[model samples]
Target chain A: MALNTQPNLFEPGKRYFRAFSPGDDFYEALIETHRDLSDEQSEMVNARLILLLANHIGDIAVLREAMSIARAGVVAKD
Target chain B: MLSTYQYPKFEYVRPPEIAEGRDGHYPVVIVGAGPVGLCTAIDLARQGRQVLLLDNDDTVSIGSRGVCYAKRTLEVLDRLGCGEEMVQKGVSWNVGRTFFREDEVFNFNLCPEPDHHRPGMINLQQYYLEDYLVQRARKLPNLEMRFRNNVIAVTPGEKQASLRVETPDGAYTLTTDWLVVADGARSPIRTMLGLDIEGKVFMDRFLIADVVMKADFPTERWFWFDPPFHPNQSVLLHRQADNVFRIDFQLGWQADPEQEKKPENVIPRIQAMIGDDREFELEWVSVYTFQCRRMNRFNHGRVLFVGDSAHQVSPFGARGANSGIQDADNLVWKLALVMDGKAPATLLDTYGDERGFAADENIMNSTRSTDFITPKSRTSRTFRNAVLGLAEHHPFARALVNSGRLSVPSFLVDSRLNTADDAVFAGNMVPGAPMDDAPIESVGGEPWLLQVLGDRFQLLHYVADAADLDAASVAALQSLAEGPIPVEPIVVAARGRAPAGLRTLIDAKGRIRERYDLQPGTTYLARPDQHVAARWRALDPARVRAAVARATCNA
Candidate 1:
């Protein structure tokens, strides 16, 4: 129910050219999700994809933690 | 272009002012002979005001524009004596089906309840609507229709509004006590006054093809989102009268409007949707980009703006013409009172207050429908697709699918003219809401409730028994009937013989009582346009007088 702030994503018996291959795979898939999209479209896809994933996650605590962490250093306009 | 229908050209005769080489003044001068202007002229003239209607053109609308007429608009037209003709000539429809890709997402019945006189909506060509209105206007002796007289300039003044009009003979100057500007969206009068409409112009285009074909499609509105034929756009299919079907294909901002309008490009699109074998002729084809905008104030001193001249909305909801008709309905009564000096000129301000509020509501709904149909950003489209995808099975998601909200009369709940309810009510017939129509039995025969409710301020008092019609109640009714701004009192009885002297309508089935949420002594004060001004559980003479005063802006 709560966010796993610690190391969470894992795959048994997996190796990569560098560490955090799971994170790299996620990054690569995210990039591929926005492959042919323009910047505006990619932003739209990111927003909707987040909503879809958030609905799937279905955890307020995890969403709050993820959102806070994502927004940690970004200054929002008034 | 339509084979089934031919446009009738009205003969323009030289006006008396031009023939006699003299200027003239009138009580009410309406610019533009469109549906709104014609309706306004008819409404004012029927109330014994002299009205001169000027139009640049001599015929009805060019094409099948504004095909859907809502129930509220039909009711307004009924008051102008044009409702029956329009309903008979138009295609009545209430059901709407929405499709997502190839699958049917949801269908809705606009008027699920029975016994209402008019349907949820009717699809009639704009030309027919204007023609019917013109015919009705002609029957009114006080209304003068000057077909070729075009208003070139308007000068609004303290006492009157002056207009420079051009006709076949020559240009002439005329003045009117009140000027009604119903000249449409591209109002030259609005431009001459240096006024501007403030709102959002959607970056989208739609091609309207009125295809004449003998097809057996049900009389229902069918809307498709991202269908296979269109492959990423929306399409709306509606049945108009005379074998004409209005097909609107949503073309995105990047689409070439001029290229898409060509018959060669349009024919294939229609064929792709309806199939190749069906024989059909393209009646009319036009591309349009819409905006949801309105003037800051509809009333500018002596000059009043009505219909498209005051506000405009996207065509998706059919709000543009319907709301304009309502605007005329709302303005005429107020203007009559102000002109007769029964109500202060300030009463006219509520026209702006109420209809301005309505304009915003319409603009908001229209803008939302436009956004859903044409998503500006990719994420919005993603959500739109998600909603459409989920809507096929899930009921909640169907609610999220917004093809078009469809035009409904705006409830002027916050209008200053509406007296706040002092008693508990259990129905939708609240103050500032349009009175719901119900079937009732009169002395002559059975007629709809609204048919008997005369075109004036009305006191609808409910009486369950003869004892309820007390001396105090009769006195109150008599006083209101004889007031400065007279209110006609109509008695609605649950079960009874006609009252001795009162005008009584028999609520045989108690539908009127149920719809109005009437107890034995329930009373309602309705405005001239049939909007509820106030209601009370029990009739109080002083309170009714105060409410009437407030409704007329005298308080």
Candidate 2:
């Protein structure tokens, strides 16, 4: 097996404050989905949303890479 | 069927006037008589150190505070002479199920194999554990338990600590060569000495309600994340002894503690979890917020901290009391050696190093579990929900569902006391890991490996034939066994082979060899707490002596 030494894709990028970005619009819409629902229903919406995104990203290798990237950055504050 | 909670009554004892006008200095003074404090006293007493145990309260803990006792904690308790009674009385559990909504997401079996003496976890009231420890402490002549005696002040010096004791009669002052602080989370001794515990205080609350009823729930741990009845919060259930069950409801940060603890409000929560058709009586109700923090240093001058005073973790992992018991276990022998002048004072520092590592491991796990249970942000909640939903159908995602990673014994990988392996070795039994227990047959009868290791430095010689060991190796073993604080040498012979001389233990059934991955002439030097100090493929006297020296901090 070849060693894939990509400069840890998990490293946190510099924060960019956005005022007119679509990311803000998506964040508001995400909160709107759980506006009046119970916590369980909100959690279900989240689960379904994750499934849809995961399905869109299809490849197993990509999913594993993404998970590792998500987990890598923060050193436990010991 | 319902039952009422009964509290034990203890007589208040008056202390002698050592502080009044006498020049008396005690060897060791332990403050607080909780399970950790009492166990520390018992362990130190077993090592022939006279211990003075003082408790402000007259009885054991008020409620069923810590009910889940891990197997490693039980092993330490067994070494202190209370194992059999605790194992007999406590409810043994090995299975845990985690549920998402009404569906079971994942289940784990902690210990499936059955040659071990203790179970993975036991559900007994904290009062019962304290009762066992106090009873065991009473029988030791070297240990003196003083009730209604509170330590109001503490001043730590280079060689000794000056302590002011408060009693009903009045106040008195005394000096001690060494002081132990096991005074729970809000340790006054820790505060008086000006020590700060640094870590995260999770903004989450939990309601603990112990109910008594004759229900048929299997002896297992059940946890639910966002259950049908308890809508957005989590809930936990465990069956204790005497028809009592412990139920904890995860109330968010904004919940009112006082109003939630009221019987009127608490009864409905219990009724919702366990149906109202099940008749039960509320034994105790408590509301607490989770905090994951610890002192920067456990060893402070002449005073040492153990249990909650040293470190505190969220209750999700049951690391709070179990790790406290382990702290006492790790400290007693080192403290005893330091007090006896057999080892240098630097040996006491390893207690802080090793247990600090453990505390960090516990804090990391507890913090992760708390965040998973009570996600602080929208993105975190989305991922947590994703993991939970995937966990139901895919085996890969099941490992992601964290309903409190259960407590396990910490492996001291970076301990300075351990001698690094320079030779080729097999098996997971490394130098710093606790020795795994296996069944062995001695001259008397079959005894567990842990039972034989006991509370002393041990040289475990795994030999196929006595003829294979060199004369110098044999002499080194003899010298170790004949030292002042002798290290017992047990020659574990291969299956059915009897090595006539020296203490021989038969590896009947070959379980010992398999677990330890023992070669023909492997040697392992273990600390008094049964933690492996050093091991080698072949014995070398110079290396063995150096390892022992380093382990005792004489180097």
Candidate 3:
């Protein structure tokens, strides 16, 4: 199965806050993955998390797209 | 420290060669009377070949080193005539629990199935093991043990290898057709011969403390990663025989080794892990940094390296001594056949090939376990902790946790000596795999399958009826038994009378048939080391002979 590049995560709105925000739950979950880690440790955790998610989404084309999109705005310092 | 056990010093006797002012020659000369060397000497002497074993020291190992013995190693020891004694005097454990912080993440049972002869693993001090092997070696008149006779020089030649030895009384020279270097990890013989081991040496350090205490801790392997008692570090707790416990603490690379080994420093750490109220005395303390490495080739001309001299692995898994015992097991039969001229000298090369493969496997697993226990980089530790945290609740994450993948025998699936299968078979007892154990009934009461199937090539033929053992099958078995390398045939009958003049074992509960995945006419060819060489659906004399020839490197 390929990675779903579209907005895939969602949560039902509560009574006071009724609104639709796609992928917000995923962003929060990703932040929680790095909860108590230090700066270096957080980066390491993210790298491992990327590998874990990549293995789960085991399509070469989807991984290539994901890698390209993730590095789109990053500039080489050297 | 030496309260419960007293070290036995073997008497050093003057060599006859030195007294007669002449050189001594032997069929096999094994250096270093450690576990591997003694085991090899015993095996060779049992085959009626004269063996000389030399050691620099007259005593067993100084400390309680190498405390765990795996089941496969136990089986080899059984063949060497000391497995029962070792098991009787050792602590047997099959459960291992891994803890993350204060919670138990997961626990595993090493042997979930029953009806086996030995347990999954046993924890016996190295001194006892060596002592047992030394005692067994003394019983063989063909084998001579020369303690305090150190080999100062080794010269390997095409036909033979010569050694210059220095005994307590004087010096002498000895030569042998084959030289086995089982000295140790820091092998002086290997250094003298200009050989090098190639691999990585881990930068982490560990402090091993063997403590004597009469406590009620269950006989199980307990490992901790970042526990409250020892935060940010790892600890391993194992129960050995004689009310002793082995505790290994991972003190990072930068810690002072000398300071960590002090009683004042080690005692408090043990107190922290096992509570302050428990009274315990330190029996032995050591600081070690492990390396997972091996020589490029185990066989170099006439000189062969076994045990730590051939390969070394981290102590995270108990692979060091266990794998070395297997190295001796794999090499002895081939060496015996070569010495007797029944097989060519090239047959010994398969020992190097097979054992070299096993060494790499052990080194790989030991390195992985070390990496998991002592993560090198911050990122690696982060991922490790993440896995541990998730493992507390998630079953998938538990599979990722590696608290020392314990040692198991390697499956020589790619061994060149094995003949490929010609028929479909169930289970993992394929060609090149070690034969699994099951219960059976014989005239001598009940014995495990492995207890009866070693020290030579064996043919386990299954039969269900008298018609199954037709004249052709009997002729095939008889002919195979008279071949160059005889194959001892043992019939496993499901429900039938014992065949006349044939060794038959009754499958009491059919567990043997189920474990071996045997049909009515199934036949399995096992090597002298008990690894499967080939299997067939029916008895074919020519095929069995060819497979035996291939297994012995006669092909």
Candidate 4:
């Protein structure tokens, strides 16, 4: 069980604008995961990447909270 | 090997009067005899207006331009007398399949409901559309077509406009009560007027190749993003009439258009995409860069701009020529009424107001599709790919993936011409929306709703049984029959009954009641373009007269 200890809780899957830094390392690492792989393999890497990140968080409540927030802005408002 | 499609040359005849330097004045002179201009001329001539059409060239369009014609456009074409020919010869399609890379991500059937007059769309060459319109135009004796007569200058005046033309014989000057500018995107008349049309020019290019091949591919629209054959770019394919397939390939802004259009360069790319097993001959090739733009107004004093001359958008959604035909339909009836002094000139102003709104909508949708297909930023590309990736599994994500939001009819919900509805309506037959087609049985034969409402202001008075609508109400409705621009009243009865005198049509399958959501004694006032001007739950003769007045801009 994960304890909500911090003053501010960081949601797991919510869309956080500009989450990445100016450094190119994160992008390069993301691209490197599928380097020279077939399209099927590349998609599998994407799926695996999602599972790995979800497992690292390991909080059902935070994932649910994040999902509702992510679904809020799919369409643009006039 | 398939043979290339041959182009037919229309003979250019020089009228003796023009050669003898005789000046002629016309009620309406339409510039450019393309689909829009030709259709406008036909519609105007059908309304008893003397129309003259001028075009610089003596042939139909050279390439297979604007292959997709939407249903709304087909209805407008039907009123002009050649919709049957177009539907018979064109490839009617209602299914579209979209693919992301090697996987089919989304597929849609535009016409889910049955019993409509025309299919959702038909793919035919632009030249064929123009040829049919020309053939139809020739039958209308009131319409005089002057091919190979190019307009050099246009001078707009208060009462009329004077045009300077250059023909094979000599230059001539003619005056017209109204000048319709349909000379295409690069309109010389628009240039002469110096009306600045402002909008964004996308930094993307596309190569269109028309190929003649006998392949057994199903007649449906197919689009691909990051196709296997053309690795990173997008591709669109549609089957046209006569075994001709129209293929469009997205070439980035940096591509050398001239070099890429060469047969040697195009053949290899096409071979890779369609495979070398099926022998194909290239018919036409052209490169285009799209721009989303429109003039400040469609109506310019005595001069009116229609079709490509008035507005332009990316060819992704098949909006270019389809919307142009609708523009002609919107303008012709109003122009005719105004020319006959039946309606005020302000009625013509509504053409600009309504069509400009439609142009903005087409631009917005096309721009979004263009951005998704050819994303400019890394962020945009990432988001587009994510949507495409999820669309493979989730149905919700499929809605977000827009290869092209294939052109649908514009709902003029905000038109000033429509009378405000006092009662709640259930279906799409709201004021300013196109009338839904319903199967009906008449004395002549079984015809759709559109077959009866032919190019006139129609008052569809729906009744439950024969003993409906009091005598006072009937007299008030019949009074509308005598006017400068007459209103045609047709009584619609429920499945079995028929009223004797008012041209009653039987709603055979009860589809009319279900689609219209009408109770007993409901009335719907439809405009000449078959769009609802107003509707009511109960009959109100004063209100119906006011609604008719509003539609003509007389109220």
Query: Which residue pairs collide, candidate 1?
Result: none
The reply for model 4, stretches above 4 Å from the true place, is A1-78, B1-4, B466-473, B496-500
Docking quality (DockQ) for each candidate: 0.03, 0.04, 0.04, 0.04
* DockQ: the better of candidates 1 and 3: 3
Cα error, residue B301 of model 1, in Å, equals 0.7
What local lDDT does model 3 show for residue B391? 64
What is the descending TM-score order? 3, 1, 4, 2
Name every residue pair that clashes in candidate 3. Answer: none
Candidate 3 chain B: worst-modelled 10 consecutive residues by lDDT: B390-399
Shift of residue B428 alpha carbon in model 3, Å: 0.6
Q: What's each prediction's clash count?
A: 0, 0, 0, 0
Give the DockQ-based CAPRI class for model 3: incorrect
Kindly report which residue stretches of model 3 are placed more than 4 angstroms away from their true locations once superposed: A1-78, B466-468
Q: Docking quality tier of candidate 1?
A: incorrect
Instruction: Compare candidates 2 and 3 on lDDT and give the better one.
Output: 3
Give lDDT tens digits, candidate 2, residues B1-555: 234445677787767674355534699999999989999999999888888999999999988899999989888998898988888889999999999889999888878766676789998999999988888988999899888889998878888999998889887787999999999999998888889998888888899999988888899999999999899899999999888899999999899999999999999888887887998898888999978999999998799999999899999889999999999999998998888888988888999999999999888777767877887766667766776776665554565667776788887868999999888777667888877788778876748788877577888888876545556656767777765567777778764433335677877668778878888778888888978899888766567778888788976
Q: What TM-score does the predicted chain A of each candidate obtain versus native chain A?
A: 0.70, 0.58, 0.67, 0.53
The predicted structure with the larger TM-score, 3 or 4, is 3
As a whole number from 0 to 100, the lDDT of residue A24 in candidate 3 is 26
Q: Estimated TM-score per prediction?
A: 0.89, 0.87, 0.89, 0.88
* Per-residue lDDT value at A19 in model 3: 15
